[model samples]
Target chain A: MRPDRPTADEMLEAVEEFLRDKVMPAVTGHLNFHARVAANVIASVRREIGQSPYIEADQRERLMQLLGHDGDWETLNRELCEDIRAGKTDLDDPALLEHLRQVAVENLGVDNPKYSAYARLKE
Target chain B: MAGGSIDAALEAATRKYLSATGIADLKRLSAGASQETWSFDAPTADGLQELILRRAPGGVPESRSTAIGQVREARLIQICHSHGVKAPNVRYVLQPEDGLGVGFVMDRVAGETLAPRVLRDDLYADARTKMAGQSGEAAASIHNVPMGELDFLEEITPLQQWQNTWNAYEKYFLEWSPSPVFDYALRWLKERVPARDRVTLVHGDFRNGNIIWGPEGLRTILDWEIAHFGDPMEDLAWICINSWRFGNIDKPVGGFGRREDMFEGYEKVSGIKVDPERVKFWEIFGSLRWGITCRSMAFTHLTGHDRSVERPAIGRRSSECEADLMILLGRN
Candidate 1:
């Protein structure tokens, strides 16, 4: 990778700007609503591109430690859910609660950083 | 054009039922992905009359799980109106020959259905004070609609509803990504499933958004699409859900009034005691349901079935619901 020009994030920013500035002004009615939604999707993509790797790694570390398991993220999570459902895991385990909270907060960071719930948790 | 391309068919149809000499002021007010709602007028011998046409346009079937069909919806409204529920009177049910897919025309009641306006706008200042109490009063009335009349509605008990929902959500999180919080919530809810205190018609989606109101107060409970038989507290609790509070989080009853007032209103109307514990259980259940719903909306966006911006944006709101659950469960 030659450290490319007009990087993906930059391109995403450009596209978001174009939609908000140029295209959004001309539309009205339902299309206008969809256009705003489209802009939001682009913004979400920008956040995901920026934040997903770290969030995934953070969650994976938490899952590995809490579940006492070392494998892919999805597999470990599957085990956690199955164990909880089958009564094999204790939901009240303090470590488990802390892990779930942190991972959920991290997800909110990516998914909707603006949510008031996220703000309350940050405080 | 007030009278759009469908005017000829509408004109003929309005004449048969409304005794209209002319039909005009027909405009497609909204064309949703699944349905279209039109506002129109029939110039009857009496005078210019405003009525609404709510129809599921042809092609993809406009239906949902066990919801009453549009024809049956009209009948339900008629039944409610006749039973003294404040609902728009159903004027005519569409026939196949009417050229509308399957819908009914009803008298358009005067009120704002938009939530933000009803909550924040100056016009509803008095109505705001009355909403929580009136909401409880209205729910009592809706619950009293005779069981015989609602044979068409689905009967889903709260226990059954929560169990099925938990199983589905469990399977989804297992396959997709797991949340120990959801697991803990599930186990907690299972351990605390309240014995059915009362069974009546539950307005499965009762909330501020479903209400049409004015300065006087609530005119009708709209969107009876998911009406079912269940613990009546399910409806009572649903209105208290934080998401429905629309940022007015302090007020437990639809962002307008307190739980005490809601209970007071309900008890006065139905003479049935309101159980706080049962209501609390349903409130938690409502939060979990909304969290899952937010995920499903995101799933649709991710899967590209409906690429609307709103869906994924709504999906991100799952955290808000989760946070609310934490508060409800007193985990904080």
Candidate 2:
């Protein structure tokens, strides 16, 4: 139903290019700051779209194993938060720690891959 | 905002309080959705004066959050200024007849509030070394503010504030989905609330970006809307929070100087020894609070309260906190 040549990622790339290369030259001050932010938003959207499925699948598997239950991503994550809050889950368990670390790192990949701390943690 | 009307209002308010006949070069410097800051020149009989106006727009209802609203914020400036704390001189609070919203006028201190310029620019190299200790001395002065005179500032312990923020964040964020790292942070913070019995004036948001500095050194601390009575260590720890460091994470004290320097400065001014454990606990507490704050930025955007590009962009930074929290927990 959709043309595949100009995919969602490509569309975002085009918009970012236009904003950075074309529109950016004409703006200054607060609007310029916001323009860069707008461009970054599009780039983030592209990353999120490309990366979310893999990240979510990995998270779902970890949550299911750690919580000993099967459910959708949001419901299980909500339960995980509640368990940790109410002292039902042990934070020090090796499996649980791995799950948390991987989840945090994967999300960082989508959100801010350039966050300087990430490089140190990965190493 | 009608510029002419505001100028007229400024003249009237200043004439009564500052004995100024007129204001010139009036301009709005920055305005959030709720508040506005204006810079202007006021001509008194002696000479020209630089002044600032911080105000809510007309007819905007007052927010009941723990923020020390405008008039009282002015009071903090006045109190600190009187005590030689390098704060601006609060000149006048707006009256209704002045046609301006509720706010106060103060002497505009000249310095750079921008973090990038204050950090990377050559003009601030000397200021950088001096900033951390200056920040500590400044905090000591703020904490030593007379207790009786600060009756209006909210007197609450850090633990209570931490719990309130954690609970609010849980309801706001956790209901949508689970946040393992955030929940872990909350539990960890609850267990280690600093064992401080005495209450002191706490500059609730003392951080690098909010501080004003120039070539010489730290000039003044700004944004006292959330000043409160709390464990003094909360202020000390808050300055060391990673978010305030910008990207210079190596130097924990506001990304400019050593933590020991801050302690030395604080002890020098107040003659009270800092409990290292208490500062450490508050540092963890600081990380948790900042992590929660980053999450709120996303929620604020999602709820349509503020649809700025920065909102969702900042929402992404919630993960940055999540990562930092893990590191702090020694999970790495």
Candidate 3:
């Protein structure tokens, strides 16, 4: 995997730059709109690839402490959902609120850091 | 309708209905999964008329259970227009003889519906200043439509709406892209379902993008597909949803003005004191509802119902709603 000069993220950046600087300017109508969206999508994927490992590790640690147990990422998340839906968790609990806030903010950092709410919070 | 040319049929039908010699410049504008919009002009006894046709493509039935079908949507506009709501003017509904399936023809109102242009463009500065108050007044008028004439619409209780959306979201996203934020918001909403004593017509999708405006101000309210009978506060809060605000997040009323101005506008028209608490509750609900809608859109991509890149991109927006929920719930 390390045998290449252009890495995954770099390749994605090249594609995104090409779309924005070249392809987008060369297109019109529906294709123009979709080209912009495609460029944004590539950017989003680059962000997700760079950020997911750290974010997921943080989320797993928080979920484990909140639930007081150990499990895989998907299972732990599912259990948390069930607990909240079943009224097992207190909505007003400070720890729970902090955990939810941190998760929302971190995921938003990967998904769309420029979102108004996320950007305002980051500011 | 199947074997015949749709263009010829449409022209023939408009000629008889509008007393026109012919129709010209007929063009398809856009097509959603269930419906098609077309624009054309007719030279008639009354002079040239600019019109829009909203119809199901090839007579395909509506897929969304929540939509009040095209026929009923047109009638609702006619009723609201009769009540001075600035709704679109319906010229006529396509008859069976027209072979055009279920649809209606209406005069095309000139205005802007795009949010960014309306919010930031210099052309709409005056309109942007007046939009929130006008939107509030229009919503008030819509909520005041007499109940006797609305038997055709469904009356959805708050719990019914919440449960149906939650169930559908759970079915689609539980195994795919679960959101703990959504679960938390759902519980928060369930525990605080506001008690309602007044049920009125809720323009289920009233927002900036659904409205038509110009420099002079609001022209016409469009898109009645999801109109129903529900809490009036739902309409008030829906316009304030963060997603509708575009980038002007500070301006909560459709990214144009303050909520107080909108509330004032509603009170002046409806003679009823607006409740801020109920509006906040529905505002949170609106955010969660949109989050669920984003999940559903993503599901369309996953399940191959629609494989467009836009679907997954919208799915990414669910996190935006989650971030919005955190802020709304004071967790931020």
- In terms of TM-score, which candidate is strongest? 3
Evaluate residue A39 in candidate 2 and report its C-alpha lDDT on the 0 to 100 scale. 90
Model 3 misses residue B285 by how many Å?
A: 0.5
DockQ winner between candidates 1 and 2: 2
lDDT tens readout by residue for model 3, B1-79: 3423567877888988888788888888776666788888999988999999898877655668988888998899999
For candidate 2, the per-residue lDDT at A79 reads 85
Angstrom error at residue B190, model 2 = 1.5
lDDT of each: 0.78, 0.80, 0.87
lDDT of 1 by residue, B47-70 (tens): 987988877764124656656668
For candidate 2, write residues B243-318 as lDDT tens digits. Answer: 7777787888887888888998889999999887888778877777776677777777898987888877887787
List DockQ for all candidates: 0.48, 0.69, 0.75
Predicted structure with the largest lDDT when compared to the true one:
3
Global local distance difference test of model 1: 0.78
* Count of residue pairs whose backbone atoms collide, per candidate: 1, 2, 0
| TM-score to native of every candidate shown | 0.91, 0.94, 0.96
